[model samples]
Target: MGGRHVLRARRLMEGALDGPDGLDEEELVRAARAVVAELGSPGRLSALVAELAAGVGDPSGCARLSYRHVLGFDKLLLVSVGTRHMLRAHVWHPGSHRAGREDIHNHRSALASFVVRGTLGMELYETAGDGPLAAARYRESLSAEVSDWLLEPAGRARLRLTQTAEYTAGSGYALPSYALHRAWCASPGAAVTLFLETGAGRRRYTDVFTGDGRDGRAQAYAKEPLEVAEYLAELRALAELIGGSEELARS
Candidate 1:
């Protein structure tokens, strides 16, 4: 996104996602699909392109973050247009603390993130020792754990951090569930990445307790999927959406 185009993207993001119940999983996907569809018609997106790209001027590292409170985190949003299949751009926004956690409370979430600009720090981790982490400790510690997992997953409280090349606008990457991965801004630059995945197999987060046997009642990541009744049904439904068969999902 350059000049006016980013401005337009920003406008669309800010203006479109600001209301209550803001772009939750469903709305976000719906908006993304619409943006992709519009990109197909030059006649439709031409004016938008011009207006959006207008004041964007040049790429500045720091820009207003579109998601101040929406994500319940601090993050700026950026866009990317895929010339390939869907024409949908990856919009990178700040992720929640549990986005790539290694705690016992969290199962796994198969996630996909594609960067749109500058560089992104792909962090991976595993639980170190068996004590609850201080609030501040969790954030900073997890931020560094990316390296620990890259080295090996056999150790305790250990991690591996590897710096991939800086990703400029249009460059992106994917994070499979294999690595307890999460991304952050690596440069003084802004970025956007598209996220697609339900994360891990739909675990009965609310049904389980934390790793340390602590009550996880207050846990935000305690996800109770739609099928609070049958885990298999919910799991199979998600697998089918991604093209996997139910038999394979059961496996």
Candidate 2:
């Protein structure tokens, strides 16, 4: 049953990506929105988790890719189609220490996210000629050998907040790879989101901005991948959270 579910999910995603219009930005965003709506549905996601936890099918080695992101969230990779596309479940725990919550950054690939279990707040920013908000910019790259993040100081940047919005469960949004933004859990409890990224025209590095005055030196952060046992445990917990939540029932 789990194997069948996994196949169905993969096919659904592939169909979206291989649509008639190809991978144009508009088409990609449309596909992402559709796929996220379908897969992020409580029933579908819960079933997928149950099957993966039961060890029914190989998740394309994504089980080992799960990790705690530096921005204070658990990124559990659910599916990977090479480097072209990735589907992940992001769990943001309440009261978790957010080391880089104030750091504004962008992704290397176009992405979208669906709030599955709680409210999410997002703020968008753009570089300005002069602004009260000043930041130290960094060019962030990943080491292929060790998967560590290398942050090289770029220069100073002034930015202006352009937009702010809040999304509740059953809602979502998409963004281009160059969109500068920061997000956090706005609800009082744990929040879960389904995130998808497309690797078409992925950039080699991403721009990161930090308000902290650490503009003089470079920094490196280690990304430790989760062990298989730990990964399975997380999947099981997610299944329970989605399948047994009263709030989800009410929603």
lDDT of 1 by residue, 83-184 (tens): 111122222333444232223211233333444334565544444454343211121112142211111122123333333344544444443333444445
RMSD of each: 18.5, 3.4
Task: Provide the TM-score for each candidate, comma-separated.
Answer: 0.32, 0.91
Q: Please, what are the lDDT tens digits per residue for candidate 2 over residues 1-251?
A: 23766778878878887666569876687778788889999878877777777666664376668898887899898876667888899988888676325479998978889999988899999999786689889999997778788899999999999999999999999988899999998888888899998877789999999887774688888888888888878877787667633322332
Worst 10 residues of 2 by lDDT: 242-251
Look at candidate 1 and tell me the lDDT of residue 1.
46
lDDT of 1: 0.33
What's the number of clashes in each of the models? 27, 0
Query: Highest TM-score among the candidates is held by which one?
Result: 2
Whole-model Cα lDDT of every candidate shown, in order = 0.33, 0.82
TM-score of 1: 0.32
